[model samples]
Target chain A: MKTLYVQGNTWLHRLSPGLKLGGLAVFSLLLFATRSPVVLAAAVFLAGAIHASMRFGVVRTWQQLRVILLSISILTVFTLLLNGPADALAVFLRLVALAVLAATITATTSTAEFIDTITAGARPLERIGLVKAADLGLAIGLVVRFVPEVLARYEAIRDAHRARGLKQRPLTLAVPLIIQTLRHADEIAAAIDARGIRGQNNRKLGEGS
Target chain B: MATRDLVLAALFAAIIVALGLVPPIMLGFIPVPITAQSLGVMLAGVILGAKRGGLAVLLVLVLVAIGLPVLSGGRGGLATFVLPTAGYLVGWFFAAVAIGYCSERFVGRSQSALVQVTGFFMAAMIGGVVILHGLGILWLAYGTGTGLSTAFLGDLAFIPGDILKAAIAALAGRAVMVGYPLLPQRA
Candidate 1:
């Protein structure tokens, strides 16, 4: 998974990822805690201010927000039709507030910082043997590594099909795709095991420390 | 989990993200589009079984949480979780689990082609369509204050499309089973 984090020296960028994320959680709760349009309007104003302060420029900011704002607009329209104007305004303000704030956090935090934060959070789960933090981190790493490779393979397969003069469909393309990926996965698992990169082998390797 | 399971699950998660490359079919009535990614969830379920399939979806959600544009239409981040249609997105994991568990139980290695296809179809419809929609519609209604009737009506537009997706996923699941066979040997 690729993050669209812009390089910045802003105050939010200086803040730790965990704090930004924690604040996002708390702020979301508070936003939903109210049905008051005035409060939510204030929240939206504050969130928009923060977004503008990030200095992503108007086009960059709109590019970040346009997709979500589209959904928010539709949601507002539906709420207006179903629940009346008062409810619609509240919904609109609340969503805009949440979207901008979340986008701000996302834009500010780099991918490495986000992963480190997530891995730190996963540590507690690891301590309980629910998962090893290393393994969980590796899984996320593998996903990021694999997405582009899979997409590239997909285009190659599509090209192959075109060369063969076969019409492409989801099932036909997907079968080969899954088979190819699973084969790669098997080889990857073997490579990881051979390198003692997981489970007890790695644990024992670090045992002397 | 074994390293192999972890790797397999991660790879499937990537596949789910890759599915987002397909342009979504936007319905004029609903905020979200009819996405191929949901079919990826079903495929993972049917191909990997419950545990791994569910993990694959969970990992995808983690990517979304980290602000990756992994969802159809490249939508993601914390706000995506709170959208009116987000219930459907969240439902993907449970729906995969439902489909996986049912397909594992209903399909057998020695089963006739007809029986296997039938089993997969039923699994996808019951789990992918029914279970996903039940959770999704309720969330859209209660969580978003859309009113149950309004939410239900809005969801009806997608049911046919979802059913079609289930059919496609079912067929793909069967094909993968024949080609690769992964659920307890996917028997």
Candidate 2:
């Protein structure tokens, strides 16, 4: 899995994973509620401070944000053309602040801690029979881990196709990826079954009896 | 249904939510902003399969419904669905189902990366892009009082990004199967 979480020791890092996640959620809500540029600016400043505090390599953070920033710039120009300067600037700043804050959160928190927090938080929802929060947490962790791995595989396949001078046909790319994923799913299922990790409902029934 | 499977679904849902945290870019010509949420949706289907995949998507949608502001560009609310993008929001359920169904039914434990990729694309197109965009365009047409041609033109910008999302979904789906091999079994 391509882990986006960066390891670090900072105030933001020291904060409980649940707290940080909650803080992000709350702060983001505030931004949406007000839509005021001043509040948004304040939020952005706070986010930047936290991001800077992480002190992970400044260059790395910048690199990660380069694409995002570029997109924002393009968007600003386009929006300005259509909606005029004021609205464009407001949206642009809001987006930049939001992205920075989110990345800051990602940079400071470890994937494991984040997953734990989410699972712990979501556990209550199990009462509604919607899903077992713990199960959702584990699923989130696996998906997070899986993202980068999948991206890397995609690059390799694309490169192979390029090397073979095959046109970038969707079929050429799509079919193999699907087949490979199914195989992986099968293996994973078998592995889980072998370990006796049965359904949660079943486990609960066994426990209750 | 298995513990492992449920865990995987939650994890994928988280990934989808995380991707949503990324900011979106607004196009001048269209009201719909470009976002990473669709990529997350694509991943959900490809990784989680149809049934569980849809469930995973529901997990994220539930978060949004509860006012977590988990959508792309930090936009979230019950009312958010009333906007033009509402159709796409509703389409996610179907997209996840389509993506999962195709992967499990066609790809079927073969482990061929190519086949998985193909399945991912098919699922995403049938579920995520085509179905999603189809609904979105209709909504846009009706909501904005524009013709189908105009609505489609507005939606055209998303096609490239949606395709890219499909590719990423395929790659991520295959990698999980290979690396973890402990993902939950199909229900």
Maximum-DockQ candidate: 1
CAPRI tier of model 1: acceptable
Worst lDDT window (10 residues) for model 1 chain A?
A200-209
lDDT (tens digit, per residue) of candidate 2 on A147-181? 45544555677689889987544334544543443
Instruction: Give model 1's clash tally.
Output: 1
| Model 1 C-alpha lDDT per residue in residues B1-187, reported as the tens digit of each score | 7777778899999999998876654444545655668889988888888888889998999888777888887787777876667789889989999998988888888998888888988888988889999999998886567778888888898898778778778888888888875423431
Interface RMSD of each: 4.7, 9.8
For model 2, residues B134-176, the per-residue Cα lDDT tens digits are 8888975554334578678768987877876676667666766
lDDT of 1 by residue, A155-185 (tens): 8888898999986677777888888987776
